[model samples]
Target: MKSKWPEKLRKGLHAPADALGNLFVESFHYLALFGIGAITAYAAVATFIEMLEKGGISVDDILLLFIYLELGAMVGIYFKTNHMPIRFLLYVAITALTRLLIGDVSHHKAPDVGLLYVCGGILLLAFAILVVRFASYRYPSTRVIDANGKDMDDGKV
Candidate 1:
């Protein structure tokens, strides 16, 4: 019969190795998120400086800034809750599309086509947001906030 000692020794070593792998993966995840948040913050500041150099800010510039704000807020929410909310993404898309429509309206060869396409996209996004809101309200998640405002699935509020 083959010796069982080697097999038992290998099994004993597996647990710590698996744990270390998990720790590395978790650490990398957080590091990537931090990098994304930092890049977004830097972009916002750079945009602000460019806007100031252009003499003054306009509505399109403000909307662009709002998109950047939404991006930062999305990253913050994900870090805080580990759950990304879809509404923030929708808000970002809507703001960006609006900014594009506003800034490029004068440049389009046929304004009607560009306006119709952008307006259609915005309408679709707004409809999707409404549907998501309705579903969330109708079929609420079991997760609830604790006193510290953290989500918990343990049926405690």
Candidate 2:
């Protein structure tokens, strides 16, 4: 006689260890997401305070603001989609590092060779990320289709 429970459900019920492991993994993921959001919020406030203190805003400062906005948007997207796009985070980091280097250049009297090298490395990484983002946009992993599996050419998907 077949049991009333579905096979998949029955299997899961039989493996309490697997279920606990999955739960722990999911809990950790959420905890980390919250931690990142908290840190980003603090950074955004700090950046705004510094901008106010400087009493002058430049293109690079504006870009730093954009980076903060992007970080918030990333968190929002994660909440909405239950997935975080590493690409978005990479873009934010690139903008942030660039802004940091620009600000350092503007405020410091002496040239720091170490910082210049670090900035160069950040620029290279940003270029790589931009290339990857362009390639992904040009060739998506999956095509969106309608209910009947017809490709939706209107870009709605």
Candidate 3:
């Protein structure tokens, strides 16, 4: 013997509780994302002020700022779409390696094994970006929008 009600109506009995739980989880997620965005913005401003106090900005400083900006942008994008692009992460890695290489060559030391390693990392990340781009072009993802305007993947790729 089984319940006569359809699943939706049967589950509707606990829908209030389920909705409350979901609301709590969603609120917590929004709060965490806002906190991260706020902290990143504060850090970016602080870095700018520090650079001003130092009386000048260098290429490394600019690159660091770009990293911060990219991080903040990534957070915003994630908050909006709930999706993150892998290429953006690769871009961040490439920029960071470039900054590290520049800092090591001019500020810290002459060309060394560490510099070589950083250059190698940059090259690797660049290749990864190219591969990802090629894959996206060759094997495109088919997205269908649901009634709610959310992208539902057809999983064709």
lDDT of 1 by residue, 1-157 (tens): 9999999999999989999999999899899999999999999999999999999988898998898899999999999998889999998999999988988874445577768899999999999999999999999878567789877876543
Clashes of each: 0, 0, 0
Q: Which stretches of candidate 1 lie over 4 Å from their true place?
A: 1-11, 106-110, 143-157
Listed in order, each prediction's TM-score against the native is 0.81, 0.58, 0.80
Tens-place lDDT digits, model 2, residues 19-100:
8999999999889889888888889889888989999878786987789789888988998888677778778877877777
Query: lDDT score, residue 91, model 1?
Result: 89
Model 3 is weakest, by summed lDDT over 10 consecutive residues, at 148-157
Best to worst by lDDT, what's the order?
Answer: 1, 3, 2
lDDT of 3 at 38: 96
Which of 1 and 3 is ahead in lDDT?
A: 1
Question: Each candidate's lDDT (Cα)?
Answer: 0.90, 0.82, 0.88
Q: Poorest 10 consecutive residues of model 1 by lDDT? A: 105-114
